[model samples]
Target: SNIDFNPVEDEDSSRILFEIKCHFNLVSEKNNDEYKLENRKLRFVYLSKLNDEVTDDKKLLDEIEKFYDNQGYPEDMNTFIEYMPQDSYTNCKILILRFHEFLNLEGEQLRLI
Candidate 1:
């Protein structure tokens, strides 16, 4: 999603200049079988500022790593979070979530929307 900030409002009021993309996976199970299916990946780029007195990059990265590690995925699964500086006037931060592996589930637990 492409977002634009408006100067008319005192509060954070930004406009999305472009389309937004989102991705999620689906799982299904048959009588005695289980399956994992992959879905299209999404990329979201946004501009936001870090909280006050939080300028330590290592601490921020470590926190994100710890959070992903505690998510309890299989050993072979991989997850990563990266932060980089941008040229925007306001303090901006970009977050990327990538799901590379699928989890196994029972058929009854699968809900189709």
Candidate 2:
């Protein structure tokens, strides 16, 4: 995770960016079934901390919608965006994004996207 100031914003909006990548396998040795878990999906998650005042979920969704309206939605990647509720420990508003490549592409393609 890294914190950076947004130069385009007028106020002091410093955001923290966090990235997580992982892979999981569902194969089992004892339970032998016709269907096998041969493919393992790669998941990439990104979390961005928003301004402190954005405590409302509606406002957070609207903010992300505005961003998509201005910058346009991503084409190559299947993306899911949601607001992460404030945690008791950190109490920070965050935008979580999960991105996956389309057409059974390799995991590295997500990095390029």
Candidate 3:
């Protein structure tokens, strides 16, 4: 999992550019069938407008890093995003899910969505 919480704000306003590129699996836990456990690259992009109180983006990054470091990063999204010959897949089938579509979902709903 990689995080790019760089502060990129114009002179007009403060906007922190937070971007994280990580792996997410589309396979749901609710599926009791054979698990497809090999999607290593699900790229999710998220953009948001931060509040004005967020002046220091780097500090925010550090704080976030520390928090994640202590509590561990989010792991429910890890999935295979690409097909490589080494993975032993007979076909080239890649599944990708947009983060926006699953943003409002929670728990089992999020996984199923």
Whole-model Cα lDDT of every candidate shown, in order: 0.26, 0.30, 0.28
TM-score (all chains, Cα) for each model: 0.22, 0.27, 0.22
Maximum-lDDT candidate: 2
Model 3 lDDT tens row, 1-113: 64445433332111111111112332443241222222111112122221122345544334333322332344432222121123344222221222222333332342564
Model 2 whole-model lDDT (C-alpha atoms): 0.30
**Over 4 Å off, model 2:** 1-47, 51-53, 76-113
TM-score of 2: 0.27
Ranking by lDDT: 2, 3, 1
CA shift at 110, candidate 1, in angstroms? Answer: 21
Model 3's alpha-carbon lDDT is 0.28
- For candidate 2, write residues 1-113 as lDDT tens digits: 54563322212111111111112222443142311111112112111333233446656456544443332343323143343333332211323222212223534554454
lDDT of 1 by residue, 1-113 (tens): 54343222212211111111112221232121211221111111111121122345555444434433443332322323433232433221333222111212111233341
Q: In model 1, what lDDT does residue 85 have?
A: 30
